[model samples]
Target: MSASTRSPKLRVATYNIRKSIGTDRRRRPERVLAVLRELDADVVAVQEVDRRFGDRSTALPPEVIAEETGYMPVRFGIRPESLGWHGNMLLVRRDTEVMSTQRIELPALEPRGAVLADLRVGGTAVRVIGMHLGLLGLWRKRQARAVLMCLEALEDPLPTVMMGDLNEWVMDGGCLKLFARHHHVAAPGPSFHSRRPMAALDRIITSLDLRVEAAGVHLSPKSRVASDHLPVWADIVPAGPTAAAERHHVAQSPLI
Candidate 1:
């Protein structure tokens, strides 16, 4: 396959919406959605999706998101009975069929969970896991531990990508080391504490075989403080000269 014929490229986004209550004290889901639309990503992982108790965030609903934007949403949470809505969500633009989806519940100061989606994009199947860790230290570490645990148990050899509001600005090599050699960190696009932002919390970490084509932070001027953290975007291709081969090697290779 020519370089162009290699794996299809994809742009992904990770955003933490602080329950749609922006600094302006207005609920602006459309503005927030507009910012996300600007990213032009094939998929997105969102945090702080307020509506745990089945309240509406905006005039638009999850089904409306698909109708308006053509991206399907997959969301999950551990708390079954909560007035406030909080959870992780995965939205995909292509015709995606979930191979499997799960919620990793964390024992943190506030309950949190993850949403994993297996997508079929351009005839290519890839796994994308979206998560939001707890705010407290002990809880965060446990959540991170759960992340590693999930990584180690992949049944398929196909490449995978994990993105979300990790809530950790400092990289101590613990979370960084979880990925294998072919897997690596993309650009260090800072995306946290959106108001007068100063730290890097939102991120996109991919398999070593993946290379970031373009990565950055995005905050719409029209976007109010619906969330504390801004959204991050990245366009990526499978990395390395043999990334395509490795991707196809799963069926023939013993590693699978």
Candidate 2:
């Protein structure tokens, strides 16, 4: 098939719901669901969806997700009521086929981890990694490398995308640099401190085989108060032959 005739672009997004606790200190899962509906992304990487204590149950229940949004959580939770592994969850549109899923444990001072899913969206086959890295710079760097190693070990080389609350503050150094060495790191603008975002801690990174067409932080009245961090999204497509030739050139310039 020709480049123009390939599958339609896929919309991917990441959000840190802060365990459904908004800036007003209210645990409203419905408000988070409203923000997800606004994003309308084909694949969403969500962080802090579960409570930290007791059973670690999900703040945004699966039943609510299925009924409120056109997406379904990719089940990777060991606990029956949790929606993800270590508060990191991946949600794909209901029609998308989930071929396989894996829970990746990262090196961190805290309990940090990532979730990987191989999915078939429309006619395109892609791999999506959702994670929340540690707050410390050293641990973030190590976690970044660990996630890359996991990708390298995977047999199938699908157009890959990694998205989540990365927790790295600096725009050009540390974990961002480590990921930039192997992938096209994209900062879709500031999404932290949602009331007045000044930190681009949330991010979306894509492999060279994929081209990011459009990207930005989703800002709205509801988004600003739904969580402590806003949502970020990227529209991507498989890089055609011509795009593949310019991969190196684009890789040098991170923001897309």
Candidate 3:
């Protein structure tokens, strides 16, 4: 599509930094930031961003992120030293306006949570949810429902996008089925085990009001070493009037 005919697009990405520990078992926060720079996303959802010990300090320091990247961490006030709730973090470009932020607790065998932000990217208002689901299938399903419930309880229903390290190995079953019932689920590609990616554990899901123009797993030399899981990104825009009408029709149509 030509520039004039194409709608404005926002690039969103999700990466599980594994606490900035690379496949080499080295803690390299700068390497993670370098990979993020390569993606050049408008907003990024990062998982395992904090150390799991006492204080739970962020792996990527706010000052370092501000100085090295074009993005800033969305502050949720969950903890003074932590940049995210649980291990989920959201980073938006410096030009984006964060209207509100929320920390959502999910049902899991271990402690797991999600971060939500209402943002104005350029002139478009959007809602972004970043999460790291549990390892077990049952907990993942319950967590998916909890996230959806949180979204429904919100007042303003802006064009929504949820992206993260889902920890789900399958494509059609598990928690993905729950998300697919209400949203467009896109597993860009296999992003797990960056050395030899064979699992599509990273994903980006969008509401019907939005359209994904392009989505893929970012595979670069830096990305391969940045973490155990590769980053996934999607270029999304508001659905055109015709597309929106068709989506509404599909929603209203009876199941076969």
Local distance difference test, each candidate: 0.65, 0.90, 0.89
lDDT of 2 by residue, 104-196 (tens): 999977788999999988878889999999989999988998898898777766779999999999998989998887688987999989999
Give the per-residue lDDT of model 3 (tens digit) for 206-226: 988898999999999999998
Model 1 Cα lDDT, one tens digit per residue, 1-256? 3323535887788877666556676766766677667766778887766554444342235655765576767645444332112467777764656677766655567767676667766666777888877666666777766765665566664567888877766664434444333355664565666776777777787765677888888866743365677888888776765766665553343321
lDDT measured at residue 3 in model 1 versus the true structure, 0 to 100: 28
Top candidate when judged by lDDT against the true structure: 2
Would you estimate the TM-scores of all the predictions? 0.79, 0.93, 0.92
Q: After superposition, how far is residue 111 of candidate 1 from its true place, in Å?
A: 1.3
- For candidate 2, the 10 contiguous residues with the lowest summed lDDT are 247-256
What lDDT does model 2 reach? 0.90
Q: By lDDT, is 2 or 3 better?
A: 2
lDDT against true structure, model 1:
0.65
The TM-score that candidate 3 achieves is: 0.92
Stronger candidate by TM-score (1 vs 2): 2
